[model samples]
Structure formats: structure tokens, C-alpha cells
Target: MPRSIRYFVAPAAMALSMCATAVVAQSFSSSTFEIPKPERQTFVPAGTSCGSIVLTQSTSQSITAANSVSCNAGGLHSDNSYFRSFPLAADINVCEVQFGIETATGASGTQPVTVNLYSGTGAFPGTFPGSYTQIGTASLNVPDQAATIFPATVSGLATAGSNLVVEVFTPDGQTAGNSFFIGSNASGESAPSYLQAADCGVTSPATTGSIGFPGMNIVMNVVGNPGGPSLSVGSAQATLVDQCASNPGQANGVIEPGETVTVQVPISAAGGSFTGVVATLGIPAPAGITYVNSTSNIGSLADGNSATATFTVTADAGATCVTGFSLPINVTSNEGATASGSVASQIGESG
Candidate 1:
């Protein structure tokens, strides 16, 4: 899992008639923590249609943690095509697609990136050649800019689920391994980025993770309309992590004093952009439960858009344990107007 930006509040002393003696609030994270890089990748096939994922990564995979300079894709001297699957809920006519560039490698000039999109039935890799049918293709030259978006033209109507498969490559226009690299971040994309090429050792659909880079993702994003994209809940299944770490007694699958509960809310904003995105638990914690970190900053949403707001809830000694708890959360963004939605999570049974 990835780390979230946290805000910690100090413990304050409140006299419970000056008699209770000791009791305090606390703070915690979903886990240790790393920059949350969210991305969307489906599957990549052989050939150089769109820009291939960089082969010989400039930055070592060993150092590919969040904020690592070495992009999950992009290599020092490898030529390969990169691909990812996007499953959006709206019906869209993709007019263009953007391939984020991390580094131009050694592209003094003449680094051409050809991108393509395929409409497919069934799931990717699982369906492969039989599922994906070419939609359209576009190309662009790699710019000198260090980090930015390079776009390609692709036309198609994407539906829900396994809608579209995107591809990028460095055809014959530029040196195979000496062109540019695709940009990626630790924002937390659900799909996997796929690559294809001989120099990269992958002749077919293989994840950057499979080849060594575990969490590498090519920021292959979409720019389409017709059915203008919107942001909504993708997955809101909130649960507890390391119950023992927060739980005071036996991990009896029930909410007990000192137990830490994690509420992870994942949202996908394919073509929807939201600002000042924030998430908070809608329902107040039952008696004895302290919402250590109740709200999380989702920040902004854009082309390569997705975010997971993780909140921490704890059960104090005074908590009232009952049946499993159902937590409702609200995700709101101010886009000129306030747009918000509520989601419920079955965190745990109150003991």
C-alpha cells in the first residue's frame, strides 16, 4: 500500500472529574507509508505503435519507491511499446490521449512517439488479440521538456468495464533506446502498465512489475468527450489493518479498545477534474471510539486521475462495542460548486 499525507493532533488533557487517571488520543497510518502514486494501465502487446515503456531504466528499479527519480517505465537504452487498459463508466469518443513523459533520455532531436487505442470485449491479457480491435492511431515527437505530457490521436467509444486499451511506441522515427521515457507517479492507479519488446525481454503483455519494477505504471491517460467523463466511487471497502497493533486485547474480529481501523476510499476520475478533494467519515464514531485522523486530503484530480483517502479510527477503552460497525464516508470537491457523495464501509463488529 502507499502512504498518505498525514495531519497529527497532539493529545490534550481533559479531566474526567480528575479521577479517570490516564487516557489519551493517538495517531497512525494505514501502514508505514510511501507517496501514493495512483495510475491506470491495462495491457501492452508486441510492436512499437505507441511509445514503448523505456527498457533500460535510467534509475535503478531498486530505488523505484515513490518519489524515486527513476520512472517505473523509461530505460537508458531499451526500445519497447507500452500499453494499459482503461475501464471508465461513461460512453466517450476519445479524440486524443496523453502519454506522460518522465525523461527524454538522450533525445537531442527526432524522438517520435506513435500512440494507438483499441476497443476490446472481455478482459485484457486474458482476451488479448481476440478481444482488442484497433480503434485509431496518432503520433507525436518527444520534446526536450524533462517532465510533461505528450499526446497522440486515438478515436473510439469506451463503455464500462474493459472499455479501451492504449498503446505507445517509438517506431522508426527515433533511436530505439535513446528516445524519451513515459512519466509515472505514485498516485495509486488500479490497472497495471504492460510493455512489449525484445530488448525489454517481454515479447507480449507483461507488467513492469513482472519484469522487476513492482509498482511501475505508465501515466497513459485519456482525453475524450461525447459522454463527458465523471468521477465516482470505484471501491469503498473499508476494513482494519494490523488489528493487533491497535487492538488492546485478542484480535476477536470485533471492535475493541485500542484497535486501529482503516477506512480507504478509492475514487476514479477518468475525465472528471475536482479540486480541494476531501474525505471524512460521515457518521460519528460510537462512544469509546476516537477518530484519530478523520479526514484526508485527496488534493486534485486530472487526466491520470485516481485517489485513495485513508482515515484512521481507533477504539478507546470507553468505546461501546456492538455488532460490526458500518461507516459512511463523504467525498467532496469544490468545482465552483460543491460536489459530494457518500459511501458506506463495514469496518468491524463492535465488541
Candidate 2:
């Protein structure tokens, strides 16, 4: 979550010593026009290997010779972080994340790297290392062509104008013995990705295109449900139970005819947090029934959390076999999440 800041007097006289975790060395970035050519390599399909379409910038199978950019630190340095951004298709919870890297070999003596998920709020790689309050994080050990599926679940993250930003932090160590390259391709997702290495004169996140590699898209992917929020999260549900004062012991999930009853529908919340939740009648009561009270307060619910909602109604005494009745409910929260559903009930007059 942190690193040191150093002062560089000039760009030419780029030799500077960094404080804290940053290594002491001259800053470096490369941008030579290399012909992008593929030479028979195992293809890494961007398909949903984790049961859902994984998100990624590069869709090409093999890394082109000219596209295979350096791992994390473009040059010899300690503590370098890279960022990539993408817009999620509405309510989809991220199930997995994977970023590619060439893996440091020989003298590099690399440390484990972390994949972090941050709330998307401005144009990506613009000025944000793109990390404010991280939503989820996972660490992976590097291999020669490390493309580890980061094991983490991210939810409730709506695209706040900006796309979801991913931070890949590499602790290349201060020694700068040797450096590895983060996996990259010529796919060029969005502005060639961004770098946040302060020692490299990149105090703020600047596009790699600005530094040097103008044709690079940090090889990273996100996988998850594209249809909606996870079944286990970000959803609301309810079950109706009837409570009657006159019929003691007869109060069992059904609405009895001619009885004034309180229909208690417990509203449940999951995924993101919810507050000031309330339920209101979405449709008029069916024929032969009258609504005494239609609004019910659900209160507050923390992430993966709570419920309590109810309404009162009465049935006509002469109504027999009151079927085809539906109670449509509209549940809303302070955050503006509106979920609507209805429960159908059939009433039988007591014999």
C-alpha cells in the first residue's frame, strides 16, 4: 500500500537515491520500434477458464516478439507498480483476476507481486495509480511466464464514470540486480497502461506511452458473471408469513379468508451494504382484499447482511376461494438500489 518519494533535480542527471522501499539507482524506460512478430508459442486464450468470461486487454494467444514488454519495472529498480483499467458490464462481480509477467530470473531476486482491485472513479491511468481504497487483493508467486489467476472476489463496484483500475505492484528490491518484464502485448487496451514508479520520474501515474512503450497493454484479465450479481451476493429476496390475532395457532404461512392479517415479508440483503431500506406496494391489492398498510421499513443492512418488512391487509367475509392474488413489492435502499418482486397467494375460507 506504500512506497517512498524522491526528488530528481533534472531528467538528464537522473541518478537519484530513493528513500523507504524504493531502490537507489538511475531511472530507465525503453521504447524502441521493434517489429511485432509471433514465433510459435503456447497460446493463452482469454476465454473464461474460471467458468465466466475473464476480462482482459490482450486477446491474442501468443505474445508477439515486439509486444513482450518487460515485467514490472522497465529498468533496474525496487518497488514498481503498474495499473490497468476496464469497465465492468454493469453488476458483474469479479471472480478472478490474472496479470502476466515474464518473471525475474538470475540476479533480480524478485519478491512476490500483488494484484489489487480499486474503485473505478476517473479516467484510468490519467492521474490515479488508480488506487484509493482497495476493494480486494491477492498475491502470486512468479514463474517464467506467470499468468496466475488471482484468487479473489470483488463486488458492488459500479463504474463511477471511470473504469475499474487494477494495480500490479512488484517489489523488485532496491538492488536492481536484474529486472523482469510484466507481461504485455500490442493489443493496446486503453492508452498503453500506466506506471506509478516515482523514482522513474513518474510521480503520478503516467501512461507507458508517455514513458516509452507506446504500443503496450499490460496483459491482465478479469473473470466473472456477466449476467448479474452473484447468486450469493448483491441481491434481495423475501418470504411472506401471515400473522392473525383471532386465529391462534392457525398462523402458518397462508392467508385465511375473512381475517384481517399482517403479511410479514422478511427482506434479505447481501453483497454490498444497504441502509434505510423500505418496501412499498407496487401493485393494488387483488379483488375482495383491501390493503390496510402498504409501506414497510427494512432499516439497515451491512455487506452480506440483514431484514424485516411487513404490511397489513384484510379479506372480504363472503369471498370464497380467493385465488390469483399477487402482492407486488418494490424494495429500495438509500444507495438507490431498486429491486421489485411479487408473491402470489390463494385464500381458503375456514370450514
Candidate 3:
């Protein structure tokens, strides 16, 4: 039997709570990947036109712990089409879908991603009902795992439980098409960021990036004159990797030189409890970025005022249940900087 690994992430303590003991919050993680070997194989009825979408199971085997299932909703690379779908349940508290998709490998740019869940039956495949709730929509510029969540109030969702289909669509409707599969039971581990952006003056353009050192997508947009200046960006680059040292790992990216730019980088997790050695690099402006919490700030550079974002990968690995990970980000620039962002992860497991 393959070795089973569980992940756990610890929460930070409040500064004023020095006399109080730190509290560790239990977070859960989940994966949206292709199943090694999917059983109960069921294909869409003829003429249903799954389009470029497909469902796959990893290797047909038993995983001691929950893993990830892959979704090929996005079409093949040559075609550039994408796919998405949702779980068949009503009054859904929380719904998540995970999968690996095309991203910035060398420099083909990144694939733009859009995820949606609709209410549909066997007969009406083309015409979906409801508001086509947007669980996650991103312009992924890298190739990695994609995971997103949708709240219960998604428009057009079935109030009652029934056999419903979930669909993932490519934003531009590229010819290569797109593909997205479900994550393994082990995947859906945690909820990284759930705070509103307006309050912080920053927001995740899309959903939080994936786990481990997959890559990071971030947007730091600011408007009008608050206590600070405004800023925006078109695009940028970021990356993450595992060092296997006493620290968890590290990652960084380049922020294009401009009043505003969009940045994308890789993020990762090694499926076990490992201290993460993290850092932020190539920050064009220090005055524009601020750390929400001083405790989470690990390192910084003074010369160019360029700072490195740092945090720990809470100890969740080597446990009995799933673990979760997340890195919150905030950006500030002179007015006119509309920052949009997204993130992804490269999940690693132990045997």
C-alpha cells in the first residue's frame, strides 16, 4: 500500500496576546486532479458533446489518505479548449473543484481560466439554467494545479438535490480547448483567504493559488486617494520551489516596471510538515506594498526598497487528516493601478 500523508497548517498569534497561548487552527486541504484509475466509468451520452472536457482517475488503487482527482475539462494543448463542472447537491455549504491545467511552462504566456457551475439535465445539455455562478475565473500564465471554491448562493444552482453536471469553460474559447478534472479525496484541504479585498485595499483577482510550490497569481489594484497612493499593473511573474531544509520552501517573481502590472508565480507544498523558507523578490516598489501583520513578515531588502514576502507552511504533514495552506497579499500604488490576481500549487506526496 502507498504511504498516506496528511497536512496541517498553524495559525499565527495576535501581538497583544503575548500572555495568551497561541491557538492553532485546524485547516483542511483538497485536490482537483485526475484520478489514477477511475472506476464506475460513466461517459456522457452520445451527442452530449463533452466538448474537449474529460474525467480521469489516477492509478486504480487505494490511498490511505485522501489524494486528488484530475479533471481534463480543458481540451488538449493543440486545441486550447477548457472544461468545468460542479457537485450534484443543493443547499451546498461549500463546493470546490480541482485540476491541473496549462500555464506558463517556458513562455507561451499563461492560459486564461474561467470556472462555472450550472443546473442542467440529460436532455438540455447546451442550454444551462441559473446565473452561471462564477466559482473561479483567472488568467493563469503558468501550468499547475487549479483549485477554487463557490459559496451556497451561486446563481442558477438547484435548490434541491438532483443529478447535475458541472462545466468548466475557457474564457476566450481557444481552439486548443481546455481540460479540468476533479481532485482526490485528499485534495480539498483548506480555505486560504476569505477576507474581502476592499477592506484591505487588495484582493485576489481570482481565487487563492494552489498548494505547495506551484505558482502564485497576484493583483494589487488601488483606486482614488485613501491614506496612500493608487497603483495598477498589466502583468508580472512569480515562482515557488521546495528546498527540503529546516524551512518549508521559497518562491518569488518579477513585477513589470510600470505604474501597474499583473504578476504570476509558482507556489508549492510537499504534502508533509516541513518548515517553509519563504521570501519575496523583485518588488518594484516598497512604499506600495505593506504587510498586514508584522509577525508573518519574515524578511526584507532595504536598498531599492524592494521587499520579500515571507511566511511559514504550518505543520500539517505527518498527521491523520488533510491540511491547508495560504498566503495573503496586499498591494498599494498611485491611483490608476488596477491589480487583478490568481494563484496555483504543485502538490507533492510521499510514498
Q: Which whole-number lDDT from 0 to 100 does residue 286 have in model 3?
A: 30
Per-residue lDDT value at 225 in model 3: 14
Candidate topping lDDT: 2
Q: lDDT tens string, model 1, 19-134?
A: 25421211110111232243222232211221221222122211122221221122333445778877655566564566666546444644666777777777777787687887
Against the true structure, what is every candidate's RMSD? 21.9, 18.0, 22.5
- Model 1 ranges off by over 4 Å: 1-78, 105-108, 160-162, 172-177, 227-351
Deviation of model 2 at 351, angstroms:
81
**Higher-lDDT candidate among 2 and 3?**
2
Which RMSD does model 2 reach against the true structure? Answer: 18.0
Q: Give the TM-score of candidate 1.
A: 0.42
Instruction: Mark the regions of model 3 whose C-alpha exceeds 4 Å error after superposition.
Output: 1-87, 93-95, 101-109, 120-139, 144-158, 162-164, 171-351
lDDT of 2 by residue, 213-331 (tens): 66656667666554432212111123445655776676775666677776655454434667778888766677878888899887776653335567787777766664657777777
Residue 92 alpha-carbon offset, candidate 3, angstroms: 1.4
